[model samples]
Target: MALDFYTNPMSRGQIVRWMLEESGLPYEEKIVAYGPEMKGENYRQINPMGKVPAIVHEGRIVTECAAICVYLAEMAQEADLAPHPDERADYYRWIFFAAGPVEAAVTTRAMGFSPQPDQEVMAGFGNYDLTMSVLEGALSGRDYLCGARFTAADVYVGSQVDWGLTFGTIPSRPAFDTYAARLRDRPAYKRAKARDQALIEAQNQAQGPQN
Candidate 1:
């Protein structure tokens, strides 16, 4: 069987979809809608978390957005999106940074979490100001997360930056603005996004409250 991508376009699955398109790889996408049988017992076998963006490749299952992006990028070597051996350290650095502090901070902000000064360090994301400063510092002098050349790290980190900015969870500073613009310029990103957006809109329509 070919690689199977379990996705719900309204979710983070869009990031994985974009990475797959960039890889120029052929895979089967099985859309899983919320509140469906696919989100129940049967699908839980593939992922106990019952999440939308899981993938089964070569009989191995991968979950988590950042992990999925890195795996597919490395698997589709022809795309040359993985970082060079010498740059692997920085590659892993920014990807994990985005997945960790950046994601936590953005999510907490979106959820209306206001951290007390004393509670800042206790929170997973420290604080919004600190998180933004750290992210901005990382991108201040670099074109990409790993610098100059784009890599799988860019796809993962750029998606976070773009989404965070769009949702107002993060500031749209010059660094984030420039990086997200570069990411949006990719044809693969555009194509993948177009499909997912339509799906998301359809989902909202289907879920709309009726009189």
Candidate 2:
């Protein structure tokens, strides 16, 4: 019944924070600073990747933003974030799509690494352009990833689109714009974002003005 969330306010932990709020579950937040704090042996034992945004639920550890979202959704069944029986197909398909192609494409672009045309087949996302096009089509006429109803899939996928637009990694397509707007309107989204933003501001203040 107890959950511990390890994260850094400025990292992808924001995505899991939103999912926590959406799941309506109470969790202990452990702030793991970057660099040595994150990679220290103690923390490394919790997450082999030495990354933030990990959760220990009833002693079971879950890492990775997308994995954590789906895990929480299943735990908080009453919140209805998990996919319904009828939505199963689209649910798993798109959630993993976002976790896979969308996630890879955005990161590769951000890192300034583009897969050459011939390397497309070797790349999980092919190329950023192709990846975005596929995502755009999925969201064109839907309010959420699984359709009109919102589910856990939207949290992961929406976070990607939301983050993409904010950082200029994902193009500002009309479909992306509409989808992001819908997800952002959720009360949980607001709460999670505000909490992370406050933490960021506090950290910045502690560091004082930087050149």
8-114 per-residue lDDT for model 1 (tens digits): 98788988999989988899998987775566988898888878799999899999999999999889898999989888999999899989988888877788886
Q: Give candidate 1's TM-score.
A: 0.92
Overlapping backbone residue pairs in candidate 1 total: 0
lDDT of 2 by residue, 1-211 (tens): 8999999999999999999999999999999999999999999999989999899999999999888999999999999999888898988999999989888888888888889989989997899898999999999987988888999999888998998898899999899998999889999999999999999999999999999
- Candidate 2 — which pairs collide? none
> lDDT per prediction?
0.88, 0.92
Cα lDDT, model 1, residue 165? 82
